[model samples]
Target chain A: MPSDALPDDPLPSWHDGRTKRAILDFIARVTKQGGPDYAPPAERIAVFDNDGTLWAEKPVYFQAQFALDEIARKAKENPALARQEPYRSVLAKDLKALTADNHKGLLQTLAVTHANMTTEEFASRVQDWLKTARHPVTKRPYTEMVYQPQLELLALLGKTGFRTFIVSGGGVEFMRVFADKVYGVPPERVVGSSDVVTFRMGKDGKPELYKTAKVEFVDDGPGKPVGINRFIGRRPILAFGNSDGDLQMLQYVTGGAGPRLGLLVHHTDGAREWAYDRKSPVGKLDKALDEAGARGWTVVDMKQDWKEVFPPAP
Target chain B: MPSDALPDDPLPSWHDGRTKRAILDFIARVTKQGGPDYAPPAERIAVFDNDGTLWAEKPVYFQAQFALDEIARKAKENPALARQEPYRSVLAKDLKALTADNHKGLLQTLAVTHANMTTEEFASRVQDWLKTARHPVTKRPYTEMVYQPQLELLALLGKTGFRTFIVSGGGVEFMRVFADKVYGVPPERVVGSSDVVTFRMGKDGKPELYKTAKVEFVDDGPGKPVGINRFIGRRPILAFGNSDGDLQMLQYVTGGAGPRLGLLVHHTDGAREWAYDRKSPVGKLDKALDEAGARGWTVVDMKQDWKEVFPPAP
Candidate 1:
């Protein structure tokens, strides 16, 4: 089918190519009447991994950067934080040195910086920060760095009776604040990592939020499938991802019976977007490459498939 | 509106006169365009408290009852629980004896009985128990004791485009198992109490669930509003409850600017269902009573409201 035949919305920007055709074909077949793959609107469940899949995840994860910045800000206020390695490293702007000691320091920084605030306060703070925060590498607002193709895909799926969800490794509380505005996926449908929070009486004797230094759940990789099962209770008929972090989620979705589609957003365009796959520490996509071919999953080559990358780069 | 006007469904056989009218009236107004307070279907968001609002809570919370039974069953095999107060009380069939101690013992029992199992195992166990477990007072299966009026309310709301959510204090995992079958509300829409759970590799090398003792979040009383705000984000225009635990939730919903409705289910028929309130230890309905009258919240007097209770009492 020609790209012109498709709705003149996001699909027009998809670039007439194999990857785009594969996705459009899958959606059309499933939604068409009398088609063997046709599923009722109620059963059109589609889940997407947020970080690298929908938005760019370069320099560092947006949440991790937030934690590091928060730690530094807190350390400046309290001299006691200088005594702490991770906090001190964060304060010194030495991400490499801080992470060199391994993930323990990172975890400690996350715990200290993320905890003790009420869930509401934390969410409001995240909302405030995201409004002003800019991605270091791209020099654009972090929200603006979101992939245009994926945004179009989300809208297309929604138009086709699919209820889309963001199942990511990012903090659920963090993504929930802006998901509705950016992705049209409501907070209820966005599931991700979370920390335990307590509802308690504030100083004024009104209910207030208090965060506990406990990991509630981490929705990533294998945890993604588990989170989906626990939270959604229904197997998604369609799934999308960009990294090894989403491999298990994609596998779980495509493994299910009935017409299912799994698509991987391969960052193959070096010019349009920073493209690093197998050797990249952040979004390593090696294992997924072998598995995608074996499982007949659609691998979206960003250079060949996407006509536009990040909302016309404006 | 006459009870005779209701369809020949089994629901009318259970709702009391006042409860029936409040439900029918709400439905009528929401569906009718020229009614005194008409609302479009999308604006209709109805939240129900699971324990007392949907099923039997007397004798003890159904989840608490399951925990105690599991504790006793484990104690019989392990013999270590004989030293524990609540487990010992549970073994002795003296649930009243544990009430003096409050929630600590109950928490301990829950941790031991509910944790360390795969999510599938826990869900299956809940489903199995729901199938066979009978309410001690009613001698009817716990599932059968569910309010037929509320079930009808759920169906009626669904028919009119209102999405019904089970907002309760019971474990979210526990409710997710049977909510779709019992309430017609899918698990994704069901918001309730939750504990931290982890995903691990199962024996077959597939991802499996492991429940943790850490309490993630509680969806009760004030927590109800927090959960609704965090999950749904949209303020519900309609709210229903039977106890003081629901007061804050109702306040949050009614505080919204647009057309709002709040209904308090008053158990005033001792013959059909337990009628004690205000002074009752379980589901206390005191402060809410004063607020309901002041706020113009609809209060359903079970004795005067409905012509029937408990779906034919079969």
Candidate 2:
């Protein structure tokens, strides 16, 4: 039967053929009346892993970079901080020395730099920094370097009665400040990690929560699925991710009854964007690669799939 | 000059007195052109305490009552819970026995009944219970018992371009599930206490978070102010509360520069509602009495000020 609905917009040179077709086909089937995978608008849920899935996450996760910078900035002003091991390493910009201590150093950096400010104040600082911060590799504003393919996917899904969500490992509060503007996903729809924030009366006589160093929740890998169920309360029929950190999420999404889709973005376009997998220090895509074929998951080869990696740098 | 925009519904009995007038007047001035307190619609923020301020917290908080009942129910089915101190007392329905253990019993009960469920499962359970549960005292659905005065006040504020937010010590997740339907406040605008939830792939092959027993954050008293600043960023020009739990919130709101209003709902209507102060175990209004007077906060005397209490029970 000829359909009355307009055809979805074609992905230009930006989106890889395989990835773009898989996404558009999924959306088309989900929205088409009487189609095998068709779902009503209420049930048309799509979730994407952030970090490497939506944007670049190397040489380090953006948030970790923020913490490293903050630790260095704070340590320069306080001699006590410079005396500390991880802080001292961060202050020296010795990335090699900092990683030698393993994840413990990362945790320490997060604890020291991300805590004790009013939530409003922290949000404001993040907003100010994001406004001017450029990606070290791309040299484009970090936000502008967001993947063009992913951006198109989000908008395309939205047009197909899909309610998209960013199921991320990044701080929920941090992403919340700009997600709506950047992704068109409202704050309430973005689920991620969070720290404890206690409400207090400020000098200005307004109620606010000061962000604490205390870890409230960590949303990553298995934690991603947990956060989705907790905050969203519905199983997404479609899920997209990059790296092993998203394996559990894909497993959960594709395991559902009836029609489901899971896609893994494989980094293989070093010419257009930095590419690495398996042994890479950040966004390692290993176990997921081994299981993709067996699990019937579509794997997107970045070099073949995405013609344009990122939007033109301003 | 007479206002042309006044509501024609004939103000509810709840808003026929001085307390209501103060709120309406503040709303009117803040929204009217050339008015001293006038603010643009985007900046018209108003925050309210949830428990006693929006709904009844009398006898005990609704969530506390739910926690206690859940413990008792579980204890009846499990031998292990019967061995625990607080659960042992709670299972016996011995309010006297439970009170003897104080906050310890309450915390233990909460830890058991509120944790371990998938976030989706928990939200569904809450939604189901809300549909059927009735207030112990009022014998009406808990949702129906929400303060009519506050409802009118919310509407009045909305008419004046203010965005109302619920800042409470209750679970933000719990309130979020129903706030939009009941109070016209969206989920994102509701801030409250929470526990850590970890995402995982469930047996059903979907991402879900298991609620943890550990406290993530406590949104009470001082926490209210902190939550406001963290979640809203902007300072509210008006605030309202019912007990000492809200003292910090009121302080924060009133402390802001320019025109601000703070009000406390004093339980003085023994005929229409329960009346108790300072010495009361629940919703204690002690420290806030002197603070309110000192800071020029409007204290609402329920019996004398409110001509009505609840809406016709649903």
Candidate 3:
């Protein structure tokens, strides 16, 4: 009876709508005593896609912005990169040219800007960046760009004994620096795209793990399910995403042999947040949006469903 | 002061010895308040090497045995494999011939037997194997061969709020099924060697993940530290291992910023368990054993320090 007792509207930031009602109804059904849909505490797993689902992903991905910043800083050290194809395009801030290359340009930019340092060095650099980096449009700290409604939803899920994870297309180490503070998720619970790392002993007799230029996993679209299987080892009962990059992840979550919930956070508020769908270069939601209705997934229109965004602009 | 309280000889299966005392002392120092070595619950990360360290790994690895069993089962379906070099050697149960071609023979065997199946299929096969398979030398179920002392140690660490993880050279999925029941570690905490996995769509339009034989990581020797850093994201304060395969992990744990405990379990009890070190082809303990004394790692001599080996003849 206590489990069935509806606590106060936990999603206060979410306007009373069909989307909000769907989330509460599912959680209640899954947590109710001796219910057919009840999942055990450990099995109450919820996974979320980070970029567009939890935070703003345009005008470009925050990670791409980080890569751009790193390139500018390192350009002073590696002048040869300034003359290269991708780097030349990157340094010139040529977004159209970079986008025309089919991820070749982005991959090259990341390989140059993200590799060759020890993991500790990389983590420290990310931490330092988080302290100073601001969103280009909002002029707010990147961490402050997280959705307030999603934060409320996350807390509600956690209160109902769900173990949350961030399965993202962004860099794993980069998200780890702020996942705890921004999302209440720990580093080990964050799975994302990762480059290869080589382990070696330092000349000073200590172990050193250095990041290399090799791309190990992409963790987008179909790769999302692969990353989930590799890291979490269990199919999530609930999955939240905003774009086509999370299509397979939602499919995987909702396909399990139990009651499942899949949600798509539709960025439809142009005033509160940037609104672009289907045609956007970054965090495009076309295919998944077309597929969502057939899949029985809840699609939350940001303007209609959410009363506030971005933690009330800090 | 309550945090300093010891739980009535947590390792009762472990005999009273210097190695046992070292474990108790390290735990006490780390859990004690204001003693300089005190670690918070979040920082109390402990990593254990599976296979030879957690369970019995003799006559060959348990995973290798699984691969061999798979080879025989699939041999009837693909007789061409039976005519192949590694398959021929494997079907003949010729270890020497299998080892002669460096790792080429075994890798090819894995590639054939381990590829193209859904992860669920592989997991089901492993579960079926576990139910019926017996160790070549011990004639006991492989699960029964887990060390009682190590199990007690794991419980003790858990009681002290230390989060335990399995970093093994075996397949991550293989260890996951039994790790929860046997070691009380959940699937996500079990980090191990993982091959590439592909995501696909089922006929029902649901996502399906399949295992591939392209070995993404080896998770042995140097790979241990890399796996730890990649999965855990924090340096473990305590590390336990059994062979040279675990040497780098011990080094990584001990090389952290604070006081750490590194342990090596020496397989010296031939009467209770298989005992082969230094010159042994499998789970060799030569270089690590030689370096343990200088490295200040506690080396537990199984013959001398363990009062009981397996779980009280369950």
Highest lDDT model number: 3
Q: Give lDDT tens digits, candidate 3, residues B48-122.
A: 999889998888888888889888877777888788777798999787787676877777777766677888888
Give a tens-digit lDDT track for model 2, residues A174-285. Answer: 8877787777876657888888777655676555567888886778888877666655546789888998988888887887777789988898878877789999978899
Among the candidates, what TM-score does chain A have in each?
0.92, 0.90, 0.93
Per candidate, native contacts kept equal: 0.33, 0.48, 0.76
**Candidate 2 displacement at residue B313 in angstroms:** 4.1
lDDT of 1 by residue, B1-314 (tens): 23354565434544445556556666777667877677765567888888767776786788877786677667787798687766786687665675556656666678777777876688888887777777888888777778777777778677666888888888888888888877898878888887777766668755555778888777888889878865665567788888999988888777666677798888887887878789988888999988998887898776666565566555
- B-chain TM-score for every candidate: 0.87, 0.91, 0.93
Model 1: how far residue B277 lies from native, Å:
2.4
lDDT of 3 by residue, A149-254 (tens): 9998888888888999999998887888889889999888899989888889888888889899888888899999999998889899999999999999999999
Q: Could you give candidate 1's per-residue lDDT for residues A1-314 as a string of tens digits?
A: 23454575547668887878788788888887788888877678999998788888877788887887677667778979787777776777776776675666777788776788877678877887787777887778777888887888888888777899999999888898888878888777888887765556667655555777788677887889878875676778899998898888887787767898999989888897878889998988989887999889999888888888898655
Residue B106's lDDT in candidate 2: 61
lDDT of model 1 at position A51: 78
Among incorrect, acceptable, medium and high, the docking class of model 2 is acceptable
True contacts kept of 1: 0.33
